[model samples]
Target: MNIKDYLESGTLEAFVLGSASAAEADELQQLKVKHPEIGYALDAIEADLEMIAQHMAIMPPPGMLERIEDRIHELKRHPVAERLPDQLRDHGQRSEKDKGQYIEVEGASSHMRIHKIWRWIFAAVFILGKIFLGFAIYFYLENRQAREEVKELKREIRQHHTIIGQQ
Candidate 1:
């Protein structure tokens, strides 16, 4: 196999991009060892890809890294176990009988608090729903009355036709 043709076949690029099949990767590894030119070509392709990645990389916001580091430090100082309530932390000390017992938790307030704007929006939606329901009922009654009038007119027309036929 021509090394030049093999290098130009894009196998190196596929391998570097992690898209090469296992067999193709194994062949590449063997070829890379036997031929210095294949290794050089692979290295060049990798360097080119790295350059492209560096050029396309986006810079994070200024304080983003510092904020992430600070968060990590805070978590390290307080750990998850330290943050748990005293009752929850004493689980291991409880006997088998006490293990089956449930822990009672108390909250400061039973009511949920939402944004003030959301309350007004919900009230508006409720009023609009009532208005739509009233319109629906009104239209339904009107349609029923219209149907009754149509039936009465048809009956009268039938009777007039019958009387004329008799004459």
Candidate 2:
């Protein structure tokens, strides 16, 4: 096999980009060990890809790393287990002081509360939709009537032509 042709076949690029098939990857690995030129070419392709990635990389916003580190520290200080209610941690057993401390949330109300402005907007939209529906129905009926009139006129014209031809 010609090493130059193999190198130029883009197999090295595919392998570096993780698009090479398992068989192709295995073959390339074996060849890399046997051929020093393949190894050098593979290394060169990887380095070029890395350099391109570094050049195209975007810098994170300021204080992003610090915020992430601070959040990690906060989580460490107050772990998730410590945040859980005593009832949950102690298998449904609650202390006397914790009994009436929390309100039992029941999904009793099905109505959703919306802002007054939104309610007015929704009403306006509903009224407009009904008006548009009325206009659409009226136009549809008018169009149907026009089509029927046109058909009748055509029939009359055909009758007049037949009568004239007979004369």
Candidate 3:
């Protein structure tokens, strides 16, 4: 029989899986017996599919399995604790006096990071404020110069009118 034609027809899929009818299975067994190549093809397909399945399976890291099991048990026992990951966790895993020190270190690290961020924020505000202040000063100086020019023009006009009156 045409093995290539049979595989292409998708009949081999059902045949390989034993999903074929009893008569079809018997026919496939006879074909396998006649052609060892058919058996090799089936074996290769199974191996390839198994490899693909394994490649797709991404197992979680260590302690994740235990955590997942704990969560499952938690859902059954204490539903409320499941909501809070921090509260449910045991600090007993931590040392006694050192736990406080660790807490302090964590707090300090967080606090320092916060302070550093704030410092940058404050510096940015200060720089922006200085820019605005400089703009205000520039506008103020411009307005003052304009007022002085107006006064000078008035004085010059007054002088010209006085000379005109004298003439």
Residue pair clashes in candidate 2: none
TM-score of candidate 3 on Cα atoms, chains taken together: 0.34
Cα lDDT over the full model 1? 0.86
Off by over 4 Å in 3: 60-167
Q: Candidates ranked by TM-score, best first?
A: 1, 2, 3
Predicted structure 1, TM vs. truth: 0.47
Tens digit per residue, CA lDDT, model 1, 99-124: 66776554333445368799899999
RMSD of 1: 13.8
Q: Which residue pairs of candidate 1 clash?
A: none
Q: Write the per-residue lDDT of candidate 3 for residues 1-167, one digit (tens) a residue.
A: 68778666656677766677988778878888888877887887788779888999998889888878866865676465444344235534654544444232132122222455888999999999999999999999999999999999999999999999999
lDDT of 2 by residue, 1-167 (tens): 88889999999999989999999999998898889999888789889989999999999999889879976866786587765656887988888978878744433345344676998999999999999999999999999999999999999999999999999
1 against 3, candidate with superior lDDT? 1
Query: Which lDDT values do the candidates have, in the order given?
Result: 0.86, 0.86, 0.74
How far out, in Å, is residue 49 in model 1? 0.9
- Indicate the worst ten consecutive residues by lDDT in candidate 3: 104-113
